[model samples]
Target: MGLLLSGVLVWQASNAAFVGVTSNANNSWSAGTVNLTNDSGGTPMFHVTQMVPGQSGSRCIEITSASSVPVDVKFYTDVTALPVDDIRPYIDITVEDGTGGTFASCAGFTPSGGTEFTGTLQNLTTTRTTYANGLGPWALDGTPPDKLSFRISWQFHADAPPVAQAGSTPNVAFIWEAQS
Candidate 1:
């Protein structure tokens, strides 16, 4: 009986001699973002103090996606104040994709092949258009960032009665909004 008890005790002690090692692992996660910016430099896009009949002017704005997520870009205009002479009906406004160049020189722009708005500035103010839809998940690898160039052009029609429009529309606002 003594020998049997000693053997059982030895077996139990050997079973308790087993060993183990443990380690911890951890990680973190965060949300993505969508951002948009324009090249206006803190001023209204178009500013014409003196426009003449049969004369046209253009402005270029470059919009970029400084984001890690894809987004849709929309465009609209708000006429804070209308022209005193009500020349809105006589001015033709057109928006196109710029071929290249700055606001002072948009000679590289290409018209949308008649998709442009040929009506008055009043109509344009009330209408909202989709400039870029479903743009992109901009690369963090630094490829040429997802970007778009726009050319906004307007003309005082030659056929308009010159005597009817002597004042200027000084407060027109163009807005760009983005959604992820």
Candidate 2:
């Protein structure tokens, strides 16, 4: 004899599990630098043997910044020594910014970047002596050859009280400062 009694039938299917993960490694930080150079090549912008009354001249210099970050460049002056006769008051200075020029001459300097300063040499040393009162905050994009040109024009006043400025030598050094 055989038993044949069944109640209910049940069926189940196996399930598969999935997993995923991701990660980032080798994280670091660094600080960039600000570097500036000029096309002057160790040459003085101007060296006048004799500057007579009503004499005038101009020079152009290109400034380049090799900064790794964006920066603003300021222009200032460093007066080497006062003239023997204090002739700075008689000398006029006109500073401009543009392109196509060199330390030797401002023949091709176009008035693109606008005038920076217009005053006497004495005022330049006294008033605009520091970066805070400097001529420019020229913006540079941090490119390797971010360049800006400056044209400095000077003149000796003609309508003067016949004051002789013979052997009166005043030296002024133009400077550029770059900051973030």
Candidate 3:
């Protein structure tokens, strides 16, 4: 009876979508609708590629928030040959608003009313040290690509319009670090 109960609990937990206070696929920003370009400053360097969701190569996601608080973002990858321990990867989430503005210029997207993730990307990016405990959610900072669940989100102003639309929406291009 004890063993059976334990197994059942483990199975149930795996099915639970909400983990680490961050949820998956909730308020998703449709791919291929985002606009890709160099930020106004142009000091920070990055690249973008167009890919259909669930198509060949890797699928990329861009999300915009309609809420006042910052939602923790996460990305889980398809099956891979390397173990989570041996790999190193990060995602550069260029969060934009409904009006097609970058996070930098958008004042309403500021993060609030959320606990700072202990291993959040902000800490890692500032420290500039690679190879932390194990592969978890980290902010994109142009590191070597690895098998990783790319997770990134930022707070958006409540009045911001929708950044992604269904079939005929304009999308943005961002470099998925997991790939070259």
Error of model 3, residue 50, in angstroms: 41
Which candidate achieves the best TM-score against the true structure? 2
| By lDDT: ranked, best first | 2, 1, 3
Error at 180, model 3, angstroms: 14
Measured on C-alpha atoms, candidate 1 has an lDDT of 0.65
Relative to the unseen true structure, what is the C-alpha lDDT of residue 52 in candidate 1, on a scale of 0 to 100?
A: 76
- Give the TM-score ranking, best first: 2, 1, 3
TM-scores of all models? 0.67, 0.81, 0.18
Q: Which ten residues in a row have the lowest lDDT in candidate 3?
A: 164-173
Candidate 2 lDDT by residue in tens digits, 38-109: 989988887876777789988889898999999999999888767667777877999998887877676787
Clashes (backbone N, CA, C under 3 Å), per candidate, total 1, 0, 14
TM-score for predicted model 3 compared with the true structure? 0.18
Give the better candidate number (2 or 3) by TM-score.
Answer: 2
